[model samples]
Each structure stands twice: as structure tokens, then as C-alpha cells.
Target chain A: MVTGPRTLAQVSEGDLLAEIFPYFAAHDGLLIGPGDDAAVIATGGSVVATTDAMVRGRDWVDEWSTAADVATKAFTQNVADVAAMGAVPTSLLVTLVADPQTPVQWAVDFACTLGRLAQESSVAVAGGDLSSAPTGTLMVSVTALGDLGGRRPVLRSGAAPGDTVAVCGTLGRSAAGLALLQQDLGALAEVDGLRAECVAHHLRPVAPVEAGPAAAGAGATSMLDLSDGLLRDGDRIARASGVRIALDSELLRPDTDVLAQVVGGAEALECVLAGGEEHSLLATFAGALPDGWRPLGRVEVGEGVTLDGSPQAPRGWDHFAG
Target chain B: MVTGPRTLAQVSEGDLLAEIFPYFAAHDGLLIGPGDDAAVIATGGSVVATTDAMVRGRDWVDEWSTAADVATKAFTQNVADVAAMGAVPTSLLVTLVADPQTPVQWAVDFACTLGRLAQESSVAVAGGDLSSAPTGTLMVSVTALGDLGGRRPVLRSGAAPGDTVAVCGTLGRSAAGLALLQQDLGALAEVDGLRAECVAHHLRPVAPVEAGPAAAGAGATSMLDLSDGLLRDGDRIARASGVRIALDSELLRPDTDVLAQVVGGAEALECVLAGGEEHSLLATFAGALPDGWRPLGRVEVGEGVTLDGSPQAPRGWDHFAG
Candidate 1:
């Protein structure tokens, strides 16, 4: 019966868990869920695992993002990692470390949205941990587990010279959205449809989570999620495979054109090339492209990434970079 | 090569990762390690997944712990959760979120110690994420995946009346160690072996990890890790299983006696009853006990926990309680 901007400090851990547990629906793969020491999930012969964390102030500002927005972004980031390996995301273990004085509503909103998104994505909500943090701090971390479904993982080191590089889903939208938020141009959303879309994309970016396995089925040689911009992630594949990723700006015009409507044309183009957190699928295929995929570049015998025959500097979001 | 007390801000993400990557050794279960969007690990028919997070200033003070100590404690906590489910830990995905000004040596020390500990524990370092946090914030989260190895998971709600309650590892040592550290008696470690051991236990408590699967093999009805103290965790099993846990303090003398050498007898007795972060295996069995396990009590026809025929209050760390 506690109400009126109640903080976590006023509630018991058991009571909070009881309120949060019902948000996650049961899944067949989850042999056991929360309430136990750990969760058990049915798995294939091989499992794909990855973890990602987001901290307040560094990853998101409360003024610009809600609890739901934070939850959505965290879910997408981890799911996209599993998807990039050509695996179907099966479950997630989430951890929340927040100050005890944090509003209970924030945790409730995050859990509800995350549970809903997990259902929509057909992933199970596994066990998790909750710990108190120092004052004014809030952080969320997610570990996504996936089933490979008997296919060989599409590794970043598998691409060859003749592979056709392609991308599925939107790029630069998140970065453009961030820019708009930074400039306090979010009001543009009230009058402009594209600007609103950009703002929405920045707050909660959606990834083509299923496109990864489709690309693998279509004979993808190498694949990854575009998390740290197209250039940086593309360079990862290039360096891992010991080849060059040569991009054709003409092929990227559609993305830049879409972004240009929200930001300026030049900035839009730059966002498309170097903006991070897009969560789009980037893959190199040996044969024909899969449905919904568009050509972006080609693999060649060289090192690093090139744009229109010129070497491009590896510039993107590096958390520790000066 | 960079030297001196260089901070993370001075290094590129790629270069930092290159420096940290060499610490982890390859394992057979890891199909892919860090450097990819996600790592692939060989799995059995089922996987046990759990996550835990530790925040600086809340979980531990820098004056009492180093990065290596924090890494060890974090790893043990996650692995103990998996072990509590009657599974063998196979791999871990770790995430580090810290301020950019955090020293590079801290990150290196953490990675190296985690790598060594993972090797000792036979767990693979699959992959992880690194992100910058707000000023003065430092957090670490770990998600551990374990193989069930064809055994049914021992749940917390499976204990029945007449089940024998037993513990597989030392209790109260961690709590006693915390008491010593709080009293500034850590310096007594130079003159007392028991005090040194208690201090070490508090800094990096090791759980009886293998005893979990062994207990399952020995027909354990229910089990859990003792992270939140005996009385509180025992109350959890009682509530979950709809039964009562009746403990005999006489059987607990071995634990209290060992703790008495470090902290006085009366305090040691209280520590054995209500101390947290023990990480020992607590189980109920319908059959004979395993070799390393010592009997403590039994399950009865009621709810909650009792000590020597008296109802015991559930007092322990709640993380959010005022």
C-alpha cells in the first residue's frame, strides 16, 4: 500500500521481486525462472553468449530517456550481439544496480517494458540480480544467450576477397536522434514527422534481430552488428578477416537521404558513416543477398576499411578515447 | 609502451582491448572469445544462467579491497549461483563500467586476476563489454553459464518433511572477517593465523562449488547458496518449500568455534546465525550425507525457520532496507 513517489529504500527486496516477477511471462525454453538461485534454459549443442552494460550519464541522460527507453536500448544491444553471430536469442539475464533512493517506478517501468519486449522477441526472462549502488548512480547490465540451431556461427573472420558486404535495417538514426536531443530540437517532433521518428529512434533504437540468421542461411561468410558505427564495426571485420571493406557511397545514399530529412545532408551522411548504437546487421555473403538486405560494399585483398577507394580513418564512439 | 599511473582516458579502446586480451587463455568450450559481437560456447542439453553485479562504495570500499579482490568476489558470487542449481560452471561474460579517469592498472589487474581465476575454476572467458561511467562510479557485472550435465536441477522448493539439512562449507567466516575489518583489526593478521584467514575470507570468500553437483548426486532434495546469511536464506527455503527448517545450535558449534578464534565466542555465534556473503552450499537431503557435508538440522511440518525449538527472526542484509 506504499505510494507517493516511493523509493526503493522503503520496500523489501522480496516485495519488489514479487511485484516485478509477474511482468515476465513463462517461456518453454526456460526450465526454471526467477525465485531460484539460478535459471535453467533448454539449449542447443552450442550457445551464443554476450554481455553489455549501460551506465547513467555516460549512456543515457534521465532528461532525455525514460526507464522504458533505457530498458529498450539495453535489450536491443544485447540481442543484436547474439543475432550478429547468426544465433536466435533465447534468453536474457538482467542486473540492475541502482541507488536505494531511486524511485521504485523506474525499476517497475524497466521490468515491465523489458518483459514485454522479451515476449515480442520470443526470448525468455531468466534469473537476475538486484544490488544497491552509491548515491545518484543507476546502471543496467544484460547478458543475452542464444541458440545456434545447428548452423556454423557467422564469424567476423570468415569473409573472403569476393564476399559481398551488405547491411539490413536503418543506420545513423540513433546518432541523429542523439544530436537532436543534444540541441534541444526535440520540439521539432511536434511538427515534423521525420524528426519525430529520428527522436524516437534515438530514444529506443530497434534492430532487425531476425535478419542475422537469414543472412547466415543465405550463405553469409562473416557478420556482426553495427554497434559502434559502420566504419568501426566494418573495420573490425576487415581486421579479423585480414581484408579490406570497400564501401560505395552510392549504395549508402538511401540511408543518408532518410537521415538528411531530420539532420542536415552533410551531417546525415557523416552520421551514416560514423554514428554508433544503430544495432543494424552488417554481413558479408558469398552468394546472393537475402531478402530485405541492401548492398553496401565489397571485400577486397587489403587491410582496414576504404570508402570509394580511399582509406577511411577508424572514427567512432570509443568510451575511453580522448 | 605506456607507464606510470595512466588513466583509461589516455588509451584507445582498441589498444586497451589488445592489452587486456592476452590475459585470458583459450578453453575447449569457447568456440569464440572476445573480439566478436558474441562468443559461442559448447553446451549440454541445458544451460544454467545467472547474473550478479557489484558497485564500488556499496559492495566494497577501495580501502579494504583492490581490483583483483573485487574481481575474485564478483566471479565467486556468480559461479556460486550456478553451482547452487546443481550445474558445472562453463563460461562467463563480464562487463566493466567505470569512469574514464579510472586507472589503467586497475582494469589490467582485474582482467588478469579474473583470467587466472577463470582458469583455476575451469570456466572460459567467453566475451565481455567495456563502457565508461559517470565520474566516481565503478561497477562490474558478471553472467555465468553452466552445464547441467544431464542431472535434474535441485530447486529451492523441493525440500520435504524429515529431510536432513546439511552445509558443505565453512560458515560465519566471512561475517567474522567483515567484523574484523570494520574494527580495524586487519593489522592483527600479522600476529594471528585465524585473523588472517578471516580477513582473507571476507575479501574473497570461496564457495564449495563442486559440492553442489555432488550433493545432487547424493540425492539432495533442495539446495541454495548461503549469500544472505543462514537464517534469512533458510527462511527462503522454508517459504518456498512450504516447510519448516529446525536447526540445532549444538550442531552449529563447529562453525561458531572456528569463528570464535577471530571474533569472540558470543559474536561468532551471532555471526554464524546472521552473517552474509558466506557463499557456502546449504542443502536438504532425503538420504545419507556426502563426505564433505556436515549435518545441521532437519525439515519439519511447518513454515519458516527455528533455532533450538524457538522461532528465529529473519535478520540479514536486504540491500534496500533502511
Candidate 2:
């Protein structure tokens, strides 16, 4: 509807967006401005940047995903990207596309959640664009910036032979929790705090922010976050590193304590091996492990991946899998 | 499709990511190092930023939107955002998530497209992320940075009563073309100049790179791009300036000529009034117009919008409108 008492029923999407931007006029870092084609922010030197977008049906639930949840999800997910690269998130920019009739408060709530999360994450809500869509789904695109206080970036292309692979933070709990949630296994909820574990793994993921710097300072050879399953993510390194990687399944058994009761040792092993969204820091060390690092594998000069020094088959999620 | 021959699949995304940092061994203005949870960029003084994202079906076609198109759209859209704010595009960071089965070449093409677009826009593809998603939909998010020199940015909040409203660059073409594409009308071939208009407005939208600085230099008070329709966008200035916006309508006829043959005069007028994505600079100035800036309207201290001094109902796009 047009603003200021013009409640026309069938308004164009552009008019709606034209109405939304004036609300953001109070932002200070909005150095440029909005309601133009884009918005601009002031930066210092090297801007730490990352972006993530959430599709309604794909990334979250319209039923369970509140406006706040959707906003928080978009912010945190992009924040995690910067964190994965061992950067300090400083500011956030959001692009929200929602259908007409989406309660105005929904947009406000979304921005408020983003603001709260940004503050909590030590970042500020910088700027954004708001547009109207023709569909029921809401799409939120988030861009996060980091302040990389003059350090070499941690990329995903430096592991070498003899580099010991180590990790910091929990793993596979999200996948297991998701499985439980999807299966509605309410009766099997008693295995080693499984319900809480599942919820913890699913609801809010805390990325290993400190581990990135710790590993970087400790002379890490390479690094990345585990957004995908371990088995698949490991392969990313192996290919990028142009080396053969090997892991000991036995090493992951200790971390499977929470899953031991529900799925037994074998399934727990699979969780550690194939489950994902752990957001843990995985790094290859050329020397001694960092303080909290646990060595789980090693890099070798060759090709492909091996389990217990033997070739293992690849098993994980595939988007196009039929 | 978990790569690396086998064994490396067990290494973990974290450990693998940790191994890739040393490759980012270049760069001068690098302030903060990666690995501290987030990266920091020291902007020295000037920094410009913008964000844009592409959701699968909403923004582009999955089958027709090649990885290159996807990448270009992501980069160009963000670049346009920064440019629209009167800043020179500088650097970009991208984040992507898709099914693992997405051909590696698709990723490569996307990257190359991003790089090429950045080059065309005088920006650099500085950083990015790649991840796996269960469902196959390409989600491309890009955040762009720009250098603002020292010009005070033109905002949408400074238009004063009596300020002449003018636009720089073509308008109505994109929206008209969009309508044609949606209708799947092959009439673009039949209508004189419709095909070029449709394709020009659809594929590669050229933002007014020179006009932004010109407007800034010309001391434009309140400025913005005509991303949405003119009548609707004009209302934005009216609301922000607390003034009534009056459009001559006849003055805007020149810009709508391309749509006349297919849409006729009335429909074409509507398209020019509310069609978006033209990316033409619209600014309100206190005095005489510049050489290329055609006068379309004026701001007056009053209420609502008027066409040629008479109250006119707004028929522009509304995101939430049914």
C-alpha cells in the first residue's frame, strides 16, 4: 500500500521499497545512503567481508522460523563465514526481500534481531536494502565485514605433507539433533543428554572464533570451518593441498560419547565421520598442536584420501543426488 | 561426489581450512591477520560498501542462469549498489552454497565471472567461500567496497520545496522488458526497437557511472537512482523532504518512447511512472537544471503527490500489495 493514507490495493513493488528506506536514515555509518540503487559504508583498510542468504523453504521453516529467527540466522551464518576465515566481524549489511502484506513489524523484528546479534557478536548493523517479492517466501541476504587487524589471511590452500590435522570445538551434534528432530524420536530421548545435545546442535551454533587466531599464531598450515560433513570437507583440503589425507576413525570414537547410546559405536563413528554443520575449526599444523587442538589426522604427499592409511569410499550429502 | 580419492574425506573442514591460509601471503594494507575469529581491514580513511544476493528462482533462472550469469549478476548488482551511492567500486567478497554435485567448472565459471565483472567495474574479487548444500540451488552473495574520495554523499533526505527533480540515464526500459519477458510475448521482434530495449534492459544494465559524480559536483541536495518507478520514487523525496511532489508527466514522455509501441501511451506512462531497475540517477536541485538533466517535477511544501499541479493517485509498485 502507498504510504500517508494512500491505501491503494494493488501497488507496485517499487513503491513499497521506496517507502521502506527512510526508516534507516538515522544510521551513522551509512556514509553514502539508501533508496538509491545501493548503500555504502566507510571502511578503514582491508575490510573483512562475507555474505549469506537464506531462502524461506530451503533454509528455515515458515512455521517455526520467526522473523527474528530468520534475521538472526542470516546474520550468524554470514558472521560464521568471516569467523571461519579467522576474521573479526565488525559490521553487518542485510538485504531483505519479502512478499507484499508481510507485516511491517516482521521487517522491523528482523532488523532488530540482526541488530541484537550484531551487537552480541561485536559487530554493528551497517546498512541494507529492502525489496518486495511476489511470492510467499522471504529471502534475506546478509553481508558481514571483519577487521583483520593486520594479519595474514587464513585461506584454504596451504596444507602440506607432514602437517598434522587438528580441530577445536564440538562436531556432528547438529546432524544427530536434526535426525532426531526429523524422525520425531521422542521415545529415544534418553541417550546421554541427546535431546539437549540435539537442540544445542540445531538451534544456535557458536563458531570457534578464538580457535582461528590460536591456530594462526601457532603456525597453522591451513584451515577452514566444517559446514559440510567431515568426510567431504576433508576432501576439499586434500584436493586443494594436492596431497593424500588420512584419518584414524579410532580417534573420533572418544568424541562420540553423546551419540553412543542412540546409534551405537558404528553410527556414532559415522556421525563424527560424515555429519556436518559442526562449525568447528579444522587446521593443519606444521609443528606442535596448539593448546586446545586435538590431532586427528595427517597430510601426506600423494593423492586421494585414506582411512587408517587405506583408501576409503566417499559418503555424504549431494544436492543433485537422485 | 566427495572428492580426493577417499582418505582425505575424513580430515574435517576445519583442519582443511586451517591448512589454506599461507596462500594469502600477499597484500600491503593488511592490518589484522586472519585466525582471530574474524578478519579486519584497516581502511586508512575511506571505505565504501554494498551487498547483493541471488536466490535461485527469484532472481534468475537455474537452467538459463549459467554460473557465469549467476556470478555476474551477484557482482554487478552489488557494484551497481555502491556506484549508485556515488562511490567507486573497489573490492568484493563472495559466499556461495550449493549441492556438492555442482560441477567444479560451475564454481570456476562463477569465480571467473565475478572477477571479470569486478574488473569491468574497476573492483577486485578479494575473497570468497564455497560450501555444500543438500538441495541444489545456487545462492550467491556478494559484498562490495568502494572509495568515496572526499565528496559528501548525495542522500535521499535533503530535497527541499522548489527543488527541481530530474533524472540522468534511461528509464522505463527495464520494467517494460520485464513485462514482455514475463508474458513470454515474442512481440519484441514485431515492435520496432522493442527487442533491443528488452534485451538492453534485461541482460546488462548499465548504471550511470559518470552521472553520480556529476550530481555530486553539481551540488545535488537530495539524490537517488530511479531503481523503482518515478512517480513512486518521487513520493519518497516528497515524504523525506516533507513536501508535495508534482510531476509534469509530459516531461517524462521522452524516456518512455521505447515502450510506446508495445504498451501504448497510457500503459507506457504507467511503466515509466512505476517501473524499477532503471538505475538512473534522480536528484532534487534548488536551481537551474544541468545540460542533460531533464526536468520532470518539483517539490512543494504541501501534502501528497500531484501530476502537473493537480492531485494524482499513486499507482506505483508495492511489495506487499496483492
Candidate 3:
């Protein structure tokens, strides 16, 4: 009971909520905030909604990632999905289901980072639930709501045979970072520059959020965020559109070349082709590429994704497929 | 891979999604459904959003609840929150974080029940996330989004002095059911009629979802769903509205009377007073009681909740208070 350190079990839910609720102040268009049973947000015409959850050991380990890192990843993943729909991120409902033994400080830190990031993005921190979990459990789930701003949602089925495949953010950096981490703890101290950037991207990846609406405005045929991998997510567009995505190795040099310096040639190619959690915007455009986007491939009359005309199976995170 | 009984770890994410996505057929206002980065839904005015998450062991036990029961409770709790905000439930984003070793049948059955319930309620099962969790972890979260239909949100902070307190549904039934479960296994079979109803209500409690908008339409001053229990939740409305909720034990006879026969007098009073998870609509009406609502108390120019002029403290589920 001494205030040296406190577990959630030592505090009331109302007390903890009162402490964190201040971080999520009222934002524009938020009619009601966190006090009520539900939050009221004024939407334009359409709302883009998505949810993403992360488990403690599954998503990130405590040794490598902090509460802020977890919050960043969870928040980014949800809003990136909203952005991929060509919608501006508006609000987030965050659910924290932690073990009673978990420290209150961890939750407070997570809420602080989540609130700060949401505010920086001009997103409202809407209310969510808190519940106790089994011992040793700590998980966070974020449901992000977005405003479409009168744009028709760009679907994966809209890509045509003649469309150009383009991406607006880093490729394989997250995977490369994971590889570094997995390869050795020595990499953490010895790595620098691009290698360090890769590790950072893996822990708290950032997406080209603005480029999503920009691509939509520039007449994107189909779009999605690269949460899985280039091959897997690209194959999603291909399968959905009933067309093949043909990627040129020459076109992918800009990314692979940079990654090769950090993780070597073969691994760099693999990372570029099949890395997960990139959070980049991948879209098919019938016209010229958008400002922040670079051409990656082309949609052809076939099926699935191809690298230099060779088929590539999905090689990324599959929730059930351990 | 002989398909007798399969674990989630045996299947790919897309394969599982493919099998379950059909359950969520498009609704009228759904611009886009699952399979994309985000689901796009059309809204008329303000959107009322609420989220609730349940852990496997904490919220329910495998010995007492099936996957269908969990789905029902999760869906009900979320929609109940949205309805309590004076809005019509429109769509839901469900996140399932489960152990990879969990059976595929559990996920499928959950989705089937969830999709069916959403359809029955005219709610779209828009899109959500599925991720593997640590061993023994199985959690489900639901974020329900609703349309305000041009009506102002009926907040808990709107109750003024001299308002009549009314409730539209059952009280203490869920907690009574929980008590029965925790007390005796013999109660399940030996108790047939009303006692069985209590147990069933605890497993999958139903809400008077329609009464929410109707109360708002009737110009009710304030309202909320009895989630954490009448006493605890009533205190919420009182503290928010800066008024006292004065209860009349005589008027609550209808609920306590029926409960008394099922669980006895002393316990029945406890259940009616502090029982939790009763998804009933409680409101303070400045005018006449609505069609389905029954008067139970009054709003006075004070603070907290009082029973027969005696002060009562908040008692019910507190997630971190284990």
C-alpha cells in the first residue's frame, strides 16, 4: 500500500481511468469524450473503421520494447488501416486488458504515449474498456475511426490489368530490424545508421499516413497498407482484382540496395519481398504516380504476385499459422 | 493435416478469414465490408462508438460458457453501451486475440454467433483483427458504432433535480445467475423456471436496445445502461449530473419481488441493489415515463445514490479490484 510502486490490483478502475482520461482531452468534432458509456463523434458522411490488437510476448517483448513502443505500434497499425482506406484518422477506442499484477505505471505510460500520438495526429481519444486478464497477460487493442472526407473508399478489387503498383513508404525495414534483433543482442549496440533505423522501424513503425488521402485524390484504383508484406499484401490485391502483380527487381533496387547495406544481399531481397509490419501505403494507380509514391510493379492479366515474373507465396505473419 | 479437429496454428489467417467472411454479408449502409484494410460505413449524423473487451477466464468459464455464449455477451455488452447513448447500433468491429493452440472451431462458432446476432440487430459486422496470443490467452473485444439519427446524445450528465428515475429492463438477473453459478452446480438442473432464467441471463444477457432511442425521443434528461450494477452505475449518473438518485424501495418491488422468489429476500435485495451486467436502460425522465420504462427512483438536488434516504456506496464489478 506504500506508494513506492503500485499494481493495478491496488487501485480502483475509476481511479486509474481518471488519471489517464486527462491525456485524452476533447478534440474537434468529438461531441462527447471518455466519461459516458460511449463516445459521440461527428462524422462527415462516411466513417472508416478498423481494429488491431497486440499481445505482450506475441507482438513485442518487454526486454526490447517499452510501453510507448507497444502503444505506438498498436496506434499506428489501426490508423494506418484507416489511412489505407483513404480516410483521415479521427478517433481511437483503446481497450487494455491486463493482469491484475501488472504495474499501473505501465498502463499510465501507454496511455500517455497513445494520447500524445493521437493528439499529434489530431485524432480524438474516445473511450474504451478495461478488464482484468489471467496472470501474466497484458494486451492492448485499438479501434480507430476515420472520416472519409467525401472520397469513395478505394477497394482492393478496383485494380485493373493496366494499373501501376506503387508504394509510399519503406519496405522490409521492419523485417530487417527484426532480423537484427533475432540475429544477436550484439546488433543492438553494434548497429548504427540504416541498421539502427531498421530496428527502430520494427519496434515502432511509422506509415505515410498523408499519402493515403493523397493517393485517393490522385485517383487510386486500389489500395491497402502493407501490414503483412509486399508479396502477401500485393497478392491480396492481385487475387481480389483477379490480376497478377508483376514486380521488376530493377524497380525495387532503391529499397533493397539501402537494406542490403545493413542486412546483406540475400536477406535484403527476402526482406524487401516478404517483410511484415511495414505499414507502408501500397496502391494501384491508372495515372502517374503520386508525389510521395514510387513505382514498384504493374498489374498484368494473370493471378497472384510475381517477382521478376516468378511466383511468390505469402511469407509473412499469419496469426493462426505459427 | 487430416481435418478431424484443427487448431488455429494449423491454418493460415487468410484461409480462416475466407471461411468466416461470408457470415458478414454487406448491410444497407455498408460501403465496404471485411477483407479490406478498413470497413467503410455511411453515417447520417453523429456516430456513437463504444468498446468492451472480455477475457476468457475472467469474464467467463469454459465449464459454464460456450463460444456462442461469449460472442453473445461480448456483442450484447457493446451494443448495449451504444444503445444507452441514444443511438441505433449500426456496425461492429470485433477483435479476437486467442492462443494459437486454440481450436479453429471455437473461432468459427464465435463468428457464426456474432454475425447472426449482428444481423438480427440490423448491425453490420464490418471488420476486425485476429491475432495469436500467448498460451492460455483468449480475449474478445467489440467496438460498436451507432448512428445518432439526428438526435442529440442523451448523456449521463444531463439529469437535473426533480427528474423521475426509471429503468426499461431487468435488474440483478445477471448477478443472480452469476451467484447461482458460483454457489452450486446443483442449482443449474434442480432450478428449472425462474432460477434457470437467471443463469441463462448471466451467460448471455439481453438488453432493451430499442428503449434507448425511444427514451431520447421522449426527451429523457439522462440515461445509461446498468453495466457495473444499479448502485455503482447510478452513482456514475449522479456524480456526472451533480445530483442525487433517490430510490424508492416500494417501486422496485416488481424486480426484487420476482428475484426474491428465485434467490430469497435478503439476497434478492442485494442482487437488485448491487448486481452487475444487467443490460437494462436506466434513465432520469423530466417528463412522463416512456412506454417500456418503469419508475424506480427520483433525482434530487444532491450527490450520490440513496435508498429510502439512506446513502449507498457503489458495489459491483471493478476490473482491477480483484
Measured by DockQ, the strongest candidate is 3
Error of 3 at A289 (Å): 0.9
Order the candidate numbers by lDDT, best to worst.
1, 3, 2
lDDT tens readout by residue for model 2, B1-322: 6564322124333443344333234333334343333344546455667666565665666533577767655665676666655666667766665544555556656766666665665565555554444444556667777665677666667888878878877778767766766676634545646655554565456667666667667778877666557777777777777788888877877866757876677778777888876667778889877666778888888966788788866556443455
Residue lDDT tens for model 1, B1-322: 8667989899878778888888888999999888898999998888999998889998899999999999899989989999999999999998988888899899999999999999998999899999988889899999999988999999999999999989999889889999999999988977899888888888988888999988888889999999999999999899999999999999999989888877889999889989999999999999899999999899999988899989999988898887
| Model 3: colliding residue pairs | none
Worst 10 residues of 3 chain A by lDDT: A185-194
Worst 10 residues of 2 chain A by lDDT: A4-13
Q: Scoring model 3 with DockQ, what do you get?
A: 0.89
Off by over 4 Å in 1: A1-4, B1-4
Count of residue pairs whose backbone atoms collide, per candidate: 0, 63, 0
- B-chain TM-score, every candidate? 0.97, 0.79, 0.97
Candidate 2 residue lDDT tens string, A30-56: 454544445555554567766656766
Q: How high is each candidate's TM-score?
A: 0.98, 0.77, 0.98
Summarize candidate 3's per-residue lDDT along B25-118 as a digit string, tens digits. Answer: 6799888898899999889857899999999999998888899999999998988898898999999999999998889899999999999999
Off by over 4 Å in 3: A1-4, A185-191, B1-4, B186-191
Interface root mean square deviation for model 2, in Å? 5.9
Interface RMSD of each: 0.9, 5.9, 0.8
